[model samples]
Target chain A: MKYSGIKVLWEGLRGNMGWKPLWRNPDPKKSYDIIIVGGGGHGLATAYYLAEKFKITNIAVVEKGWLGSGNIGRNTTIIRSNYLLPQNQPFYELSLKLWENLEQELNYNSMVSQRGVLNIFHSDNQRDAFVRRGNAMLMSGADASLLGVNDLKKMVPFLDFQNSRFPIKGGLWQPRGGTVRHDAVAWGYAKEADSRGVDIIENCEATNFLVKNGRCYGIETTKGVIKSKKVGVCVAGSSSQVMGKIGINLPIESHVLQAFVSEGLKPVIPGVITFGAGHFYVSQSNKGGLVFGGDIDGYNSYAQRGNLPVIEDVCEGGVALMPMVGRARLLRIWGGIMDMSMDGSPIIDKTNIKNLYFNGGWCYGGFKATPASGFCYAHLLATGTSHHDAKDFLFNRFEKGRLIDEKGQGNQPNLH
Target chain B: MLIDHPLLGLRDSSEFIYMGDAKLLNRPNWKSKNSKTKFIDYGYLRKNPGGVHKELWYHEQGDRSWLVVTRNTVTHEILKVELARYLKRKENAK
Candidate 1:
């Protein structure tokens, strides 16, 4: 049943009870050509692209829980291509391009809004650095614009621009940066993948991998043993535990990242605004709630909840930037475990084990990289080569000392 | 979370700065063969388990002493806390 305006009109006239379930909930099969562990945004997108682009329909995405139960539904939903490094800029730019046409390509609306993103800079040196970063973004074929204090005052007059510390001087804006409906991405990809004959097995956890010699050929799941020609693991924060079953240690740490939303109010914030001297970044949702988040809890932990100190710190940052935020009643707070990589970047490459791949280590920024992570991981699974855009996100870079450390915080996952 | 400090009775965790896994104190022999690979593994790889973990937390705003805290990552419950120097002395005795 294709969803169109005519279909909607007919359904509206005829009882309006003709809506169907988005995707199938089929039992697990004996084997598949490829098995993607972790049916989050990345896994579902990988399956969707595998069928849509590579013409590979014999794939199964096994999830420990239901769809939209992981970071896909637990993120701040901000998307942007305003990266600085040569390795990260082109990759994120590709993601932004994909986000532009994702709703059309999937025939589902993910609410990819490009309301623009403004990264505030405090000091003159920070402004100079942002100027250089803006040039870098422009060089990578992405749009960028610098705004001074006067322009900022005209745009968002509510900011505490004259604060004693961390005064806002200017900002680097990306006009094409904004938020999206995060869970819709998972559902759309899952529906498309299921429509293309790819099986999505929910509540089936991959307990262990069938490793013989140095190669992986299958997985032992809670359901049963499932054979596969190739396996790709995209289990975000669970990357360490999932790969540790094969005696492989990763340069990834699991830390709890917290985000909060306030009670709905009149529409105020235009787009995403990030504080330069602090870890706070905020945007207003269509529901009029102010959605915001700060840094991770700055420790290694698998708990999906954060401590109170970090919450207090994040709220202080919010109040410091926008004094009006202190008046808004805090509605809700949530946390998701982040796979903080050693260099504050993602990893999408084949592991040492043959025919087995790993695509975790997204740190705190996986939500914005959903499409490209899937596209690149699907390309790797299909052709046995890293996609050109994701070639720098290899696992060997750590051992080879060619790390793409964007933050320059070497080896310390907490600091990154 | 309140971390039970060894020197000071139960104190707020905000007073401490978390460093990382306590195994980092076991720095590999740099003069040995394959020091590069050893250092790379020592510097990068980690066994970030979801169960019991021994980590380094510095009492920056407190007594300014390094302490090893054994805690559960899943529950975020502190099990035991000990001074790092004492633990090092015990390791050197071994």
Candidate 2:
């Protein structure tokens, strides 16, 4: 009877209500304190933070399907605080700290591995840029070390330092940045939130919002109308659609990002390795599979399947870094939808709608920022103001022309 | 559409008179590891505004973009110079 967040998540996953209703709750009608759309990391994290931090237990996190069964579960699971912009660095650092204590805090096994993270530099200009970024990280109380080629070789011995297109150069190393179990994070948060009295509704899609007098009063879902005084649109990819119901057109684009897992082999990659010169990053999952992902699909698509171009690109990048992996068979490759913003950051704030809030536009870096996002959103809800730490990510930045374009690439793909 | 070099933070757009293996532009002297890179020299301006400008751009960084240069169409000279060198003159404060 003590339906906790983890318990409820497990039930929903196991089809406690059964598979049919989990995917298709034909007559969805209900009301609760808050209706969070999309059961991904943002949605689940928002619910967890609202209940645990704000003590607002009447919240209902409605998912189109099972939790973490979307982008939340399909990301590279990288956690780092190496942002050049002052606005993003602190928020991400908070998330990094949260990740360090996640296993204990959530009372769940998230398998958070802070082995380390390396961003290899291939040019002097890149080296200069990363030097500045590393300095910024240190200024913000985060750890970042600039290492030379010898440092890199010592850290990752198996790397093909001798013969490579972009030979081994120094790198920016964050001892704390690493990977976590993507699915476990989603499930852990959902379970913890549910146990804390938050309603974790799965297979219950948020079809629309019920706005009265220009304020969101509740949501119209496949399950029916869920009444609530406040609502949070935590959906990432479907942000435009969900916000459209309330007449808000988010300056967000839906792009596809793909990742692949190689068959289990003896773990070669100790920590997360990212080619500063290429769109590739790899981390060995606890289960021994090498989980790797890189740049967007070059085109937009709601379809979940990936194309050969990115796969080939990612493989080539992988092989270029670690030749041994060239022999490992790719077990499976999948894709997820990312709500890429005009700038490659996130938007977590109260929407133009009075009580409707948002925590979206994570791009490819959602997993790492989940905890910080939830923390800041909860702070906003509890204090009735934007967290001082997150003023840069305001939803109106686009119109205000104050976009925090970190990479200065002026494109979304460069944001991550 | 012409784009900036994918990994290199610069642009040059011209038909690559010749393709050469990339080489890394920077490596600390204290390190013994190989720092190689590659690049293509097209005879046109690759629209990479936030990148370095050079006739020959080694894509030391990844994130495919455009690269522009002045290539001898007849001779197919890959080592051609960039015309933008003259514009380096600082703008006068009128």
Candidate 3:
């Protein structure tokens, strides 16, 4: 059913019983033209765009669990395109643009709020780096502005500006960047894809690839062996395990990245804010809870739980940035496995196995790249070519020395 | 998570910074003709086993010594720990 103010009013008058399930619970078909593994945001969005843009509706998205059960629903919900690298800036900018009109395109309230994302600088060197990044963002046709200390104070007065160790200098603000309802993105894309005749089969795990002559004829799943002309693997943290089933060892490591939400408070943070001295970034949720996160657990693990030391470390950063946050009682914390790539960028290229594609290694930037990742993956699956915006995300970039090291952290998956 | 350092005894894992696979210390001869392929394999590829594996850990907060830690990736159990410099000396003596 189409959602609108009139629909809400009509339903309200009729006891509000007209609402239907977001997406259909369909059984897996025996075969499909294209089968996408993993039903997170990227998989769902790829299915949606494959049906809408390429008119390839004979698609099925197989998920081991329910939709949005992965990193899609476990992120801090922030999005931005303030990148300096040429290989990354354009792709993320396209994602930001897609997010600008996502709600209307999907006909679902994903709540793509462009409240802005501010990256604070504590030193002169950091400010210069941000200046270069902001310039790169503008060159990519994305909005960016360098905000001074006074502007930051006016915007977010709760920050501890006079800290002797790390004083606030300035910040690079992208006015077009903000947060969205994470799980709603999954539901919206799943609904749109289902509406376009794409089957979203939940509880169906792709166990192994049925490759006789390395052409990837089909997949063996929990349900049964389903045949497909092409198969795309888009599992985020499980990328290694899924692809390893076929002896494809990716340069991706699975690390547990934790996120925290505080008890509900009054509206405080106007937008997303990142502390430059450390790895802490925070934004206030619509429900008035402060949602935040920091670096990964620094070890390779597939577990969805984090140790206490990282929690204390993240809270320390938060307290150092804004002392007021220390008083807010801790509510809850959760962890998601991140498929961190070596060069701090993603990979969206076909594997050595013909007709089998891979899309993962997003690191911390996966949630923001949801739309563009899907669009580019779908474009590649529909046509046998890389999307113009995603040309740098080649699988062999590291081996070829064309690495897109956005953070300039060399060859470290955890640092990225 | 706590690592029982051989010298420092029971230290929090946070006090130490982790670097993957102590095999990184075994640098291949750059003068070799196949150095490019060797470096690529050394820099990018890793065993990343699920069982006991040797890794590098720096005790930044306590002894300030780099250690070669043999730990299980699945259970995070520390099997052995030795100073990396000592291990290097032993290798050189050998």
Per-prediction DockQ: 0.89, 0.02, 0.44
CAPRI verdict on model 3?
acceptable
- Per-model RMSD to reference: 1.0, 12.9, 2.1
Scored against the native two-chain complex, candidate 2 gets a DockQ of: 0.02
Against the hidden reference, what TM-scores do the models get? Answer: 0.99, 0.76, 0.95
Error of 3 at A179 (Å): 0.4
Greater-DockQ candidate between 1 and 2: 1
CAPRI classification of candidate 1 = high
- For all candidates in order, the CA lDDT equals 0.93, 0.71, 0.91
Write the residue-wise lDDT of candidate 3 on A148-196 in tens digits. Answer: 9999989999899999999999899998999999999999999999999
User: Which of 1 and 3 is ahead in TM-score?
Assistant: 1
Ranking by DockQ: 1, 3, 2
**Candidate 3 runs further than 4 Å off:** B23-35, B47-54, B64-94
The alpha-carbon lDDT assigned to residue A100 of candidate 2 equals 92
Residue A390 shift from truth in candidate 2, angstroms: 1.6
Per-residue lDDT value at A139 in model 3:
98
lDDT score, residue A53, model 1?
95
Residues A1-416, candidate 2, lDDT per residue (tens digit)?
A: 33358787888898786322112222334667677777888777877888887888777878888767888777878888889899899888888998899888787788888999998888788899999999999999999999998887777887777655687768899999998888888878877887787777778887788877778898887777889878877878677667766566565656678989999988678899987767899998888899998877643345666557668888888888888889999998998877777678788888777878887888777788888888887777666688777877887676556777787755334244
